[model samples]
Target: MLRLILILFLCGLLASCQYQRPEDARVQIQEIEGQARFTIDGQVHEIKGLAGHTHLQEAHSIGANTIRTYDTTGLQSILDSAHHFGLKVVAGIWLPKSHVPWLYKNEEQRVKLSKELAVLGRKYRDHPALLSWCLGNELIFYDLMDFDFSSTYNRLLDSLRSGDPEHPVGTAFANYGHKAILNFALKIRSLDYLIINTFGRLPKLSEDMNDLDFLWSKPFLIGEFGENGPWETEWTKWGAPLEPSSSQKAEITGRRFKELPREHPNFLGALFFNWGWRHEQTDTWFNVFSKDGERSALYYALAKQYGDSPVPEIPKIKNLKIDHGTNANDFWFESNQWHEAQLEIPESLNQDSLEIRWSIRTEDWFFLKADSPPPLPDLIEYASDRQKIRFKTPGKAGPFRLYVSIHDRSGHFAAANLPFYVVQ
Candidate 1:
């Protein structure tokens, strides 16, 4: 009787231990043939990712295997969605700027920040779709000339690391501030990788990497990059840049995509500037999709670069003008007059479920400043098998632009714009 009781007690203890096993697992990053790559659940993953919020289905359709978000809000839903689509995420935690010296100096603020990171780590560390923890976006960009937050930043990273050891932790810096970034990175001792957000200066990135490599031998990824930014493009007298046309942005994206993987061996992956619209300097600046969720020309361009299959080209708008104007591209129109605008599509497009959308709106120059949002463009018409647009000009006299986007069922699109004046 004594021997039987001992055997039963041991069996119950073993069952309890098996039931309490941890469900969460950590992802791995390994060096292969002198290059660093990610391993999701022990399988190597090549990251083709986009930044910002996009519909899960649309994001998956474009060959994006990953997405990067800049905040932890609604993170469970985001993680669940990514897991459903077999996508991974470089989750971000927003860090307060170092411009406020008091925040970093105060013990209360330090504890608060550390606790926030701890909560995040405990909540999401075990998620199957998590790639890494990106602590902040360009936190050191503005502080480079003023102060150093290495101690604060490092402490926060340490807090997260303590709570979660399965994933890596890193932060993003702007293209400039190399010296300050290097100084802080060297002091941390726990940083796993480097993420840099750059724009026009990307051409010289390879040289900069060699410089950084001399001091710290670490892997890096381009956190955010688009064809151009307002600061990088040509500016007008009022200190605003004349944004490049959608077609120009598309062309640049194609060329940049082809060059990223081939540029540097340490270049693990890149996240395109934006997946959705935000009113940064201009409503149309870096957004890949319009306010109403129509894919931009850049979307299709990226699709062609990302997918192995051939993609259909977006329709071209050769000229836009008031009816029978002497100039091929005359955009001036009388407000009271009815005019027909013509579009010339390229014969090269192999049409499959082709559709077009047109819209007209007042110029958005007044609300183009940072943090101010411009009004969403009012859509005019949705059409099928249409090559011409007929409409009366806006009654109120102001600058306006006519936009036309052509799309196909295969998830490809083309976009163009014509700026015009409506005279009283």
Candidate 2:
């Protein structure tokens, strides 16, 4: 039994020592000098894909200097597109769902994942376009939302610091900064920043931004904030929406303008809830992009806050069909530069192709061979050919989405989205 205990101790030490990062390597927080403002590197973005999803161009057009990607899969393309547009990307990978009922069988798996979590921080610690590393998104739903604010939270933050010393490390709370997140922040105090998400339900939402310092005595960010759901400001409660009037949207949304950085001292910047388009149960609210490629009021509001970069109207497409399946000829790029994507018809053009009217800048997600070497599509001018179809792409803050609306050769029509991410 003594020998077993010793073995376990050794294992623990080995895990802890494996991958460690210094904690001081965090993003520079602009301490208020005189104007009560720190140097603003970039305005943070929420990627806007929460409801449905939006094209990266919309986020870019609104002048987002940074975009938030929730997990590994959600991040790759987001970072890729944001970087292309000279934007920074925030990668938020969860530490394995803590509240996943019946999921890990024992405590050992939890610690093991934590050790691995440290390794993740180290791995991406040096990426140039990486803005921040988020611990988890709305994680505390764990203990009836009371969330044990003690050791568990500390371990997550420590793992992040140990692995990634530079760049702010934090999590986005669905609710305001209360005990759930405070439990972790007050104790660590080292938390580079805190993030808060608020909907219309919260009281004095904008005014509350200033009080963050009073609550934790540390810094904080307005992570997510938007109007009430169904999203139309005029939206009536459940089962009663005939879509609120645009006037209602403009009114309630205008309130956010009051929260803008015209006066706040403690507030850093606000990251709106989403960048893409989404529809929720008869109520379509929050999304800044539309399925037809239209922009939303919030996106414009943001443009005014920062600088505006209007998106060129996306052209339409015809006769485009993407072969649906998870692992088809998938090719991936993980660099931090502007990139264009143009995939070609595989000799296996067995998949549909060629079109009419015009093709919007999106393409089918072809899963390419893992070993298909260079002439690789890393540059703005590089080209690749296969099958009969050809794809040409440019590097920019893409994470660009394309819709292939096909008008049948015989005169029929259909459309689909091609999804891809560029990693920086």
How does candidate 2 score on lDDT?
0.47
- In model 2, the runs with Cα more than 4 Å from the true position are 1-26, 34-54, 95-105, 141-149, 185-189, 201-203, 206-215, 230-251, 308-424
TM-score versus the correct structure, for each prediction:
0.75, 0.56
User: What lDDT is reached at residue 308 by model 1?
Assistant: 53
Off by more than 4 A, model 1 = 1-25, 141-148, 261-263, 313-315, 319-414, 417-424
Q: Which residue pairs overlap in candidate 1's backbone?
A: none
- Against the true structure, candidate 1 has what lDDT? 0.68
| Clashes, model 1 | 0
lDDT of 2 at 305: 55
In angstroms, how far off is 33's CA in candidate 1?
0.6
Candidate 1 lDDT trough over 10 residues, lowest sum: 14-23
